[model samples]
Target: MRLIDSYRDKKTVDILLTQIGNINVKHKYRFMEVCGTHTMSISRFGLRTLLPENINLISGPGCPVCVTSQGEIDAIFDLVKNNDVIIATYGDLLKVPGSNGENLYMLRSIGFDVRVIYSPLDVISIAKNTGKEVVFLSIGFETTTPASAALVKQLVKENIKNVSLFVMNKTMPRVLDFIANQKEVMVDGFLCPGHVSAITGERLYEPLVKSGFACVISGFEPVDILMSVKLLMEQVNKGKFWVENNYGRVVKSNGNELAMKLMYEVFEDCDACWRGIGIIGKSGLKLRDNYKEYDAIERFNIFIDYDKSLPGCRCGDVLLGRINPTDCSFYGKRCTPDNPFGPCMVSNEGSCAAYYKFGG
Candidate 1:
């Protein structure tokens, strides 16, 4: 098969690797890729093995499903168990276990209604076709919030009374400052998410640069990743910190204004808990007061009274780049992907899953 994009070509990667190896002496650097897709791509392409000895790439709390707090999962479980509601959610979330070791998938196996959907608007079809009530499990970063917003707008247009949203969506830029100021560990730079940056813009991450952290918006392709790393290195070499976009083809200075407008139209910023990274202020998206009628949390009276990850799961340290997935005692023993004990093992974009697939 012919590979259309030569970014993955061995020759190109070798050249970039050589250029990286010849850079002048500097302090050891930790570049955190704050996108789960970047983590998966870096592992899949064996990019880590080819990196210069001085530059270490760390994973951040990027995977939406993995970072979803246990309490939220339990709350959704409660909604399904106690209320007459059917859940429409992405397939990845179906198997993510809550506090009781049950997930949307297991609940479905026992005859609870949890429908896997590729689009948030699919809930409208379920509501329109069946007389039953439906709730869409909305989850993701800025890239996905627009879709949920569109769904809610459609609900208002069609006057769909039975469908509502259980919003678990989050945003990225607000968390960067919180992470940058942490005393436990320090990141030398950031490889921002192209997917999110396309919606939020390169400017959204300017604050990190202002705080003296080198930031670069990067794409998922191998060439893209190398290009971003190269730019970050240049920033370090000159003792300069600024926001740059290596993936300018998709990202813009201001980002997609229409998407942002639509997103904020129905959702408002709120403090949210990241499974491993603790709660950060205004990092989560919840329905606006005007959109409360479309909110499943209010409609179902769901209470996430409990919120705690499984004991001994070192996902917190793993996310902050303080430890590797293997550092956890249960990583390979009790936390294999087939039967995961921690949230990180369940998502393909998760650090543990990446280590399991591509070696730590």
Candidate 2:
């Protein structure tokens, strides 16, 4: 409680805000938060409104659920139609809109079997009890990949044959490089992800900083975000590009070795597509050769329809920071959380969902 409260302390928040306000900066700054949790916290805490007008905070492809390509979503539904594998997924992926607004939950309501689970470990009971193959639709950044890796090793150790992971996990460093190098986008700095930094370490962002962007790994609290902003403003004022860790409590210089080792043991880097962004090579995770038996994609031989986004849905552009959620024609009217036309509105961590739900 003390640790949590200390980060959220009003006095600290005020001090950061005052320090940030004291900077006589005149230029417009765009800082993208590469974590969905950070986006949600900024929106939930109304930190964006409190920040200096010169500093603009935008959402990135940080929401792993939001960035999941349409092909993966369609393939999951296609798997359900085959009646061979039981789809076990985490929460957000279920309702995320796919090609033509089809989702697992929508199909489940019409009698398709889809189960929401909290962790990859839960699939053990699911596969054991059902005798059918369980395809866990694994998705997320480095933070969640270790759990999937651990599950694969556990399956191999226990000789559990009924479960496999349809791994759609992504890497952060390469994608950040992709985003920063885009000439069309103007990103002055990055509010890097805390959890990803905890796994990959602060050095993961050092290359991007070297490429000329002020980067800061931030905690989720209001004060933490504000402090990061102040730090970024300082970077901008000094015309310096660098990386800093405002979330020092959780993130270390080198990050967690065990989690990264677990991930490296089971998965290898692969070229993967982002939802709005095109294919980023070596930006995805795939099962290693030894773990091929536990790979759902290899086991099932999946195919996708390759659907395109519907009209007036700027979700793809939103993911790239090309525009804001409010800029979308379907934002508040045609598209919403209830009847989401895009994945951005479907997931709670999505930028569109954050804007709509919290009125930020």
Candidate 3:
């Protein structure tokens, strides 16, 4: 069998599922998988249905677009409406609505130059070809931040003057810390994000383990996820809490050090607002003082202020794993993929989107 197919082998998946089922845990256990891909994987594979009733797999603030504050979304819309610059961002962000229900897709239809880019490096060509200022809407966790950092470094080294970054890049650890302490949700352990762990390493979650939480860095495949759950069950069975590297093939103890160094060189920590979870301390990345020339907010003289109230929208609760997407009153009615009432419904990786699409 091919190496990629080995992770999807049904026999191995069933074996891991049996192993997870054999664990003799009497109490209820809630484990949150804090990645958009993991959420999608779980929903797509129907892993939750195979698990025992004692175990609950919850979704956290993993979707970058979903967690971005409405104020920032409004800021991006305002930037496009008032300025004559090219706006480039990821495709998932195209449909996300501002506080006033305006989005880049709508703006693009009305003659705004909004382009959907697959990579951060794509903006360089757009800026060079158009001979106009291009502001890239950069957003993601540690996994995608290095690429954005690399883009900034390249722009600086080449003295590219027309491109700037509207950075909404967020770090995972601080927000994880916030989630760990919140009483609204009960997370006994974390099925840590494989992609982010590959960038930040296993050591980043050591503090949470020290604080008495089970953590297993998990991959996205069926067997990989099942094995991760088996590892977490082992911890619960033994009454021991530790960081288990179930995804060691990609994640290292120290992570990709060079990538992290590149990221920190261009960005610094700042307080950031999560869409439904309020402001988290030092959970986000901003361009460093030396790289301030590439900051879109500063260049355009824009202010970001979040409108925290999303009346009747329980997206925040879904993000926190306090409630499921189906529990929301407007989830299937007012909130759908085509017409999203909240950001969670807009992004493919979002919990609401996952549940809605796959019936989780």
- lDDT per model, in order? 0.86, 0.87, 0.90
Query: Which ten residues in a row are the worst by lDDT in model 3?
Result: 304-313
TM-score of each: 0.97, 0.96, 0.98
- Tens-place lDDT digits, model 1, residues 245-341: 8987889899999999999999999999888777888999999998999888888778764357778888878877788888889988988888787
For model 3, what is the C-alpha lDDT against the true structure? 0.90
Off by over 4 Å in 2: 305-307
After superposition, which runs of candidate 3 have C-alpha atoms over 4 Å from their true positions? none
**Candidate 1 versus the native: TM-score?**
0.97
Of candidate 1, the 10-residue stretch with the lowest lDDT total is 1-10
User: Mind sharing the TM-score for model 2?
Assistant: 0.96
Task: Pick the TM-score winner.
Answer: 3
Q: After superposition, how far is residue 327 of candidate 2 from its true place, in Å?
A: 0.3
Q: For residue 209, what is the lDDT in candidate 2?
A: 80
Give a tens-digit lDDT track for model 2, residues 240-320: 887798988999988998999999999999988888777899999999999998888878888754454456778889888
Which residue pairs overlap in candidate 2's backbone? none
Clashing residue pairs in candidate 3 are none
